[model samples]
Target: MPAATFEPPAHRGLLTESIARRLQNEIRSGAIPVGAKLPSERELAVQFGASRNVLREVLRRLEAQHLIEVAPGRGSFVIDQSTADARSYDALYRAGRPTVRQLIEARIPIEVEIVGLATSRATDVQIEAMRTANAAMIAATDPVVKARADLEFHDTIAAAAGNPVLRIMLSSIGGMMFEMMLRSNSDPSIAEPGVPHHPEILEAITARDTDRARHHMREHLSLALRTYGPDLDLSLDVMAANHIETLLHRRSTP
Candidate 1:
């Protein structure tokens, strides 16, 4: 591996962001080999002319992007890149800043396929995990928790894909999509309380019936599209926030 070099960003107001970008550039350029241990926070702070707090924040940001992992009593290490993994995929997702519609469109193809794959690949343990996630979703009363469980359930299917790369891609999109859905659908009460498709999807996968898995996936997505979808009428609140009210107000005046 090469000695890591820092690439300056266009702007550098925050020390943490600057540090993160520099580190990210180094990783992408192969200066820092995957799975390499990073310098200590104190050393990094001294090297970057930043405080320990600043360096730690920078590390946190990278960890969130899955570029690095910090272990307690151990140290921060660059995530291994050898196997097809979620790190780069997660970093790409974080870099894109996707919107609700973009996320949904991205999810459709991957999710539809994941179900079919799960039917073939799912093990008994994985099936039990999916059931646990389903139960969590049902037990959740808050939108955020429900959204998380919903994402986890989908992730379970992707994990069953038995392909690390595919699973990474699925999880990257699923994590961000979860947050986006929660934010966009601020009202938890708009649709039904919990995930409605989990049981059907689970049953299909458990039975090893690919057609049934695909059918259930389609049915679920169709319902999701109709419910929390990005259509103009998804919610009055979204409309109000987006100035549809002002447009309607103008139309009525004319």
Candidate 2:
């Protein structure tokens, strides 16, 4: 992406969110390609016509969303979607982000099969990864980390399935899935009942019990549809958006 062309929405003064979302679109679309390095902070400020501090704030947003990895001395780089998978359908989500219901619909069928395959095919390391993610989900106090961990719990299963096509399909909706997880996991009441489902599913998979794994996965995924209702993507995300607003404010002030 080019610099010095950052356009802020007319109603907003600071360009932090705008610049972050702009980069998010490019990265999510694979325009920057996985593992590609981003422009330096100085370079990005020049491109966006904002301060280096504002640009730093923008990078934080991307990091929180898990779209980029910022190494200490090295520059930021796009993280791979599916490490072993070949093709990506990330282009499909570029036009507009999918709603929670649409994303869950796409995920349930694919993940259900993915978990079944994973039950039979998962290696020791893969199972350990699922265990680690579940522990993190239970421990997370921040919404961003909670959402990321929640997604990781399922993603480890997809990777373990050893089916590249199915894994790539599951990864295609990751951004929206993060949004869905954010909504459901942020609220204590809605999030509580669903907590044990991950461990149950993990236990079944570890035992190589395919039917049990699928049953738990289906139930875990189904709770959002009923609990979230029609405006889930909008309302619950408002709580998440408030957190973002807090970050933006803290970032904007020197």
Superposed by TM-score, candidate 1 places the C-alpha of residue 65 at a distance from the truth, in angstroms, of 3.2
Relative to the true structure, candidate 1 has a C-alpha RMSD (angstroms) of: 12.5
Q: Mind giving the per-residue lDDT tens digits that candidate 2 earns over 3-122?
A: 444433321223564577568768867798998999999999898777777788889877776778899999998897554342244434534445556666777898889999999999
Tens-digit per-residue lDDT, 1-254, candidate 1: 11222222211222343366678768755799887999999899779766666677788877876678899988988786544564566555544544445556777788888888888988999999999988997786544566677778878888987878778777756645564444433344334532456788898898899998998787766554545545423332233224323322333354
Estimate candidate 1's alpha-carbon lDDT, on a 0 to 1 scale.
0.65
**Which portions of model 2 miss their true places by more than 4 Å?**
1-19, 22-54, 57-91, 94-97, 232-254
Q: After superposition, how far is residue 208 of candidate 2 from its true place, in Å?
A: 1.2
TM-score of each: 0.54, 0.64
Best by lDDT: 2
User: With candidate 1 superimposed using the best TM-score fit, by how many Å does residue 134's alpha carbon deviate from the native?
Assistant: 0.8
Worst 10 residues of 1 by lDDT: 1-10
